[model samples]
Target chain A: MSNAAFVIIAIFTLAAALAAATLRKLMHAALSFAVALVGLAALFFLLGAEFVGLALVFIYIGAVAVLIVFTILLTRRDVGKDRGFNWAGVLIALAVFCGLTWSILKTQSLSIVAPHIRALTVKRIGEALMTGYVWPLQCVGLLLTAALIGALILVMEEKR
Target chain B: MTPTLQAFVLVSGALFSIGLLAALSRRHAIFILIGIELMLAAANLNFIAFWHFAPQPHQPTGVMFAIFSIAISAAEAAIGLAMVIAVYRHYHTTNVDQLDQLKG
Candidate 1:
């Protein structure tokens, strides 16, 4: 049932994330990251966070991933051949993974009874945004506006 | 039955590690940005998972936090890419290891 689906999506997410990190080609890594993000969004949906899941797809897949691909295309040039693999980086990442996995397994505080999931509809989210969380919601709007202007300024060509 | 919270937390930890590897090892600035995005998603996954499984399910605390985080991260991505573009234009290169003029 749902557990099977979760396992499948979780496996896909980890595999895609691994590829995204390990792939040499920038474009391939970006695509793999997109796959990983999509898998995460699916997991969100399966976890009953429907609005956040859809927003993940909309924002990450639709926006951030595409932006990464565009940047890769723009920055493309014939650099020297890839230096194969960086063993030091691999060792560092492996160490971090092993330590984190061990600590996560050893920690007992995370155990909790799984509460029954209630459907989180978009209307409820919108209402929450407009009510209790209104202040942060407005702050987010301001942040986005500032980011847009700043990006334009940064990328704009200077006059001779 | 639903997947346990422990399962979700483990997956997030694994994803965070993968992103850390990419950010640390990759020379390309774009790859670093992609890694950062992966890391942000992992953190967001934790927030959503805890929110979903918390004993008090009546509140939308996790959902609101995740939404704000996602929105802000989108802004971060935009600003990061803009900086990447500026760097590429200035140095004629996007490799982090080569841009060492800042080293004292």
Candidate 2:
């Protein structure tokens, strides 16, 4: 049953991602991207990383996707007609897909080898964040702060 | 075929490739940005998969990396979008092919 659920989520995610990439309308692509992110979050939940999954939902669905949509809204550009896919590009993409697929299949076994699902609860993650991985956590915090300031400057520059 | 980690990885690879193709082929800078995001997501999926399958009792490294990647991606998107906007304002078009000022 869990496997079935995983399959469903994976299918949804792949489909949504393709749609997001291929869709002609910018608004439609953004919507598809949201759907893909939701599917990814569901997959994360099934993988037993509940905190990571929920964080994906919160950060992606709530923040990132919204920001993209806001940018689209601000631009007010026409969502032009579908520019037909270039054959050369399609062929290149196909080659890449085939190469990657072959490499992954050859190097690793696909079987579910490890079943030891550790608790990825929010509290556990919080503890880990502060204790063992404190330095990296602090680095991430500083990075985000810098990014926030940078974004502010960029947006402010646009207004002037 | 039964769904395996390989299957998931293959799908991710496909998505990433598609994103790369889109980024390379598209003239629109915003679409290229979107394609880059797709590739980033593909990398994130790989991390989560490794964390799930690794034989360690405690391997939160993948998750940690994903978190940092997400933050960096957000920052990248912001900066890239800002550049796109500025370029659009100057050239009045988002098409990359149209910008030929460096040809001199």
Candidate 3:
């Protein structure tokens, strides 16, 4: 059943997220973050947003995770350094979870099941991106270009 | 059978809180960025869930939003990690706890 699959993926994601939050080793934590993203993509697939799911896997796991690992490798004086964490932050995260869960449970409107709708294919997404969302897509492209140049400028060696 | 909308929301909430924990608690700058990425993904999950559960799920608004969001987040991660590397070049340390000086 899909419910069982959802449960499994949810548990896997949560567990990997927790590991990423708590792991002492930086590389391990980054890898765990990738795993968590994969599980999230699985949840997206289960929700029937297949294109987004694939994008999630491709971007987060393929691009973002590798980028993080490379950044870690590049900016390193100590690879085996101890990653100290603040217990107060953990307490705050728990408090946030409690508040969110309480509000979600108290709201009766969120109990509805998913509607039977036509599949959201990649073609439809492409069509919308070309038609109604074209401007935003172009803006995003420009933003990405600006980000690339800005990042390069930021990390450029200062001429002494 | 498919789970209810609340179920998906709850999972998203849990992932978000975990991300908050990572972003707030971690000592390394890259770890903080990773946490922020997780938080963004959690929001994307919520958007997709709502789009799926809508009364009339005709528009592909949520999927479009998620795609754009992912794009923006990628840019953000690139810029943030670049900042991390630049700061490391100057300070020679990746731990945020030690980078206390305001003006380098």
Candidate 4:
């Protein structure tokens, strides 16, 4: 049952990703990207990373995707018409896909025994963050604060 | 019923390639930023998959790494979109193909 679900979700993810890449309308592409991100969250859940999966939904879908939509709204006037199919881009994507698939299939690391599956709890993650990974966590918080300030400064109109 | 590591890796690679194409070929600046987000998600997926399938999964290294990646990407998107807005304010267009004033 879970395997079937995984396959279905993975297919949905790839399809949404393709749409996000190829869609002509910027708004449609952003929506498609949201779908892809949601599918990725589902995939993360299937991989036993429940916290990461939920965070993906909350952060990417809830916050970042909404931010993209807001930005689009703020700058919607100059969206140009679709310029038709990009054959060169498709070719490049296909070549890169081929190379990556070949490399992954040939790698020997795939032969390792499967690790035991264990779902990580939020408490454990919080504990780890506050203890073992505090420095990086602090840095990320600082980066976010700085980014927020910089964005505000960039968007604010200058006083006359 | 679990998917193999190879399957996960292949899917990520495919997603990454799609993202690369979007980043490279899209004329809109926002589209390029969306492509970058896809690429970052793919890399995070790889980290999570490898961590899940590793023999010694006691440590939450991959989870930690993915979390940090998410944080960093969020910051990147904020600053990048701010730049996009600034550019549009000045040049009045978001099409990257036409915003080539920096080209030497």
Question: By DockQ, who's the top model here?
Answer: 3
Candidate number that wins on DockQ, 2 or 4: 4
DockQ scores for all predicted structures: 0.71, 0.51, 0.83, 0.67
Tens-digit lDDT string for candidate 3 (A65-143): 9999999889767656754778998899999999999999999999998777898778888999999999999999999
Top candidate on TM-score is 3
Report how far residue A1 has shifted in candidate 4, in Å: 7.8
**Which residue pairs in candidate 3 have backbone atoms (N, alpha carbon, C) closer than 3 angstroms, thus clashing?**
none
- The single-chain TM-score for chain B of candidate 3 is 0.95
B43-83: candidate 1 lDDT, tens digit per residue = 99999989988888778889999999999999999999999
lDDT of 4 by residue, B58-94 (tens): 7899999999999899899999999899888888888
Residue-level lDDT for B16 in candidate 3: 96
* Model 4 ranges with Cα > 4 A deviation: A82-86, A111-113
Per-residue lDDT tens digits for candidate 2, residues A1-160, read 2668867888899888888877778788888988998988887776677777777788877877887787776665633633645568767877888999889889756756556565666776778778988988778788778877876676564444
Pull out the clashing pairs in model 1. none
The predicted structure with the larger DockQ, 1 or 3, is 3
> What does each candidate score in C-alpha RMSD?
1.5, 2.5, 1.4, 1.6
* Better structure of 1 and 4 per lDDT: 4
* Highest lDDT model number: 3
Stretches off by above 4 angstroms in model 2 are: A81-86, A157-160, B1-3
- The Cα error of candidate 3 at residue A98, in Å, is 0.6
CAPRI-style quality class for the chain A–B interface of candidate 3:
high
